[model samples]
Target: MLTVKPILPRFGAEISGVDISKPLSEEDRRAIIDAMNKWGVCVFRNTGLDDESHIRFSRNFGRLELAPLRRDGKGRLAHRELFDASNLDMEGEINRDPSAVMYRKGDRLWHTDSSFMEKRTSYSLLLAHQTPKEAGETWFADTRSAYEDLPQEMKDKIENLKGENSLWWSRKLAGADISDETIENGPKAVHPIVHTHAGSGRKALFIAAHTKDIVGMEPEEGRRLIRELIKHCVQPQYVFKVKYEPGDLVIWDNLCTMHRGGEFDAENEARDMRRTTVREGTEPNSKDDDDPFTELFTGMPKSLSRLTAPEAEA
Candidate 1:
């Protein structure tokens, strides 16, 4: 039997006694899903999953979304369904590309994955293949708890408001160098600032770094509000930090929480992780056809990007 233990008072749980490398029975899946709905984040210790096994396990939740191709058009790391979240390049060496470095820096800012896409993201499954020696933890904020703590008046004020999200806008905030074409073709999506969890029917504050501005408000005012809300959501009591280890898999509900990668010595340490996201629903948004990163990969070479083994030297 799988054991679920609370890791934090309000938001995270540690799940043990299940090997994710093999197929999960229906009962196990239900228990896992129930735990996710209750805790918002679940950590599976010692999963020991390879790229293929990772994809297989993630599919148990829902249909997997293909990762966007690298800007270089070389190909994606491991399987097409895996989003490469490593500091290393295709050759398993520290990446020195200025653009890639800047892009990775944006992960330090709290945000939900694929929020700029119309289809959005349901859950994110991140498997740690390698970890730095220190200070490379990931932090998660319980937006569901943040929402519950809000004043009734504040809740009422944002009840019907929507925020526009753009990938280029977040990159700009991180001071990343991006091309005109990338911005022009980037996704712009509008989603409710307050999201209702599909399975649990609970509400959560959904604003994050990708949130550019509120739909009908003045730009500066919307930005100010977003900044304030993010500040409130990340208060110490509402946050949980995950210090990763190789063979660890952390699954988080993108709809109810916000997360950011912790700072580490990218120049000296190797931090490699792979992620697979499940879409919230079956149908793709019409605007998904215009996703800038998707367009960049069209006609790109098909090559399997390599992953650094956990035992590999930094």
Candidate 2:
């Protein structure tokens, strides 16, 4: 049996007492689902879940979204179901690629997982494999609460607006020179800005870094509104940070929350994280893309440091 304790007043919960590595018992599975339904984010501390177990645990809930392929056409991780959300290169060394460092910076922006995918993701389970000495907490924003708190006029204004989410757009914003061919090859998903969350029957704002523009409106006007809503949604009261310990797994509903990576000493320390995402709809919408570009999003600052170093510049 598992017990769930609420970590925040309205959104997060901590669940304990189940060995997440093994096949779940009916009681444990039901309890986990119930907790997930009520709490948008659930933290499991020290459950001892390895890569295989992590993938196994996720399957009990929904189908796992395969990790995007690397530049070599294979997932960087041993398993395609596991996303390599870390600062290490494929060889487990600090990455030295200049363009890749910039692409990784995109994760620092607040966004939902898989929003740029055609079908979108329902949930994301992020597990910490290694932690830096300090800083690097992951911050989450309660978008469901943000939507409810919206002014009636604002709600009416965005009632029918749909946001076009693009991985290329975010990469460019983060200063990555993604080739035009790569941009044209990636996913650009469209979803409603004011979405009625099917699981909770609550409304949530769907704005994020990946949101390039709102569909069917003048681009600048739509951008202004998106910015306004994001500002409101990420107010201090609606946001919280979770500092992870090794083996910690935090699961959050992608439909109702937004998250950003906290700053870390990227040039010196290591912070290795992995994730498994669950697809939203029953039917898969698009082909699995080999996203060696953005899949490499993580901390790697050695090259960036040299660019700004006085000795290197002069």
Candidate 3:
């Protein structure tokens, strides 16, 4: 039987006693799902998963989305499902140049993965292949708890609001040099600022860094509300942090939580994290016939285009 220990007063759990390398039995799978329903995040330590097994394991839960494509038309991992969340370059070395790593600074802002995708993103199963020596922890906020704690008046006001999210907007906010082509044609998604979480049957604030503005509202006023809501969502009571170990796997529901990456000495330390994102559904949303995310990967890696010469980048 799996042992689940709650790590925080409101949410987050640590699960143990499972060999994830092999297929999980239906009983074990349901228990994990139950834990996920109760706790927005679950930490599994010493999972002993490599890239292949990691991909295989996440498949048991839901359909995997293709990780963001690289501009150079190369992939380090065999599976497109494995998204490289590392501080390292494609060559697996630490990136020291500030400009070359500027785009990554966006990760520091609280956001849900692939929220800007047309399809609703559900769970993010992130595995640590390598860990930084210090200070590379990730923080998560219980948006569900945060939502329930909101003032009744505030809740009533925002009950039907929607946010227009954009991938380029966030990249631009992080001081990345987004190409004109991308700004004009990038992927955009509109989602409710507040929605009921299916598993837990609780309302959760789905707002995050990708939420650029509110739909059908004046820009500045809408953004102010988003900022205010985010402030409330990340209050100390709803927050917790996790420092990863090499074999740790942290599964989080993007629907009910917000997460941000912590600062590490990227110049000197290696934090090779990989993730398989399971969207709420396998099919694209009604509006997306051609994959809407195609525009994001068009140019060279935003950092490389600005910092390195063509030959040096290669």
TM-score for each model = 0.88, 0.86, 0.90
- What is the TM-score of candidate 1? 0.88
Clashing pairs for predicted structure model 3, backbone only: none
Model 3 residue runs over 4 Å out of place are: 97-99, 178-185, 282-295, 299-314
Question: What is the per-residue lDDT of model 3 for residues 1-314, given as tens digits with 9 covering 90 to 100?
Answer: 99999988779999998888788888888888889999999999998898888887888778776754555567666667777777777577886667657767778888888887778878899998889788889999999999999999999999999998976677677787777466546567899999999998999999988898899889899989989999999999999999889999999999999999999897898888888877785532222234333354554445545433111100
Candidate 2: regions farther than 4 A off: 73-75, 178-186, 283-314
Model 2, 144-222: lDDT tens per residue?
Answer: 9989988898889889889988866776767766564555455567988888888788888988888988899887998
lDDT at residue 240 of model 2 (Cα atoms): 85
Taking the candidates one at a time, how many backbone clashes does each contain? 0, 0, 0
Compare the candidates by TM-score and give the number of the best one.
Answer: 3
The whole-model C-alpha lDDT of candidate 2 against the native structure comes to 0.75
Candidate that scores best on lDDT:
3
How would you encode candidate 1's per-residue C-alpha lDDT over 30-126 as one tens digit per residue?
8899999999999998887999989888888876777665545564375667877888877788876666666677788889887877877888999
Weakest ten-residue segment in model 1 by summed lDDT = 305-314
Which lDDT value does model 1 have at 291?
Answer: 40
After superposition of all CA atoms, the RMSD between model 2 and the true structure is 6.2
lDDT of 2 at 270: 78
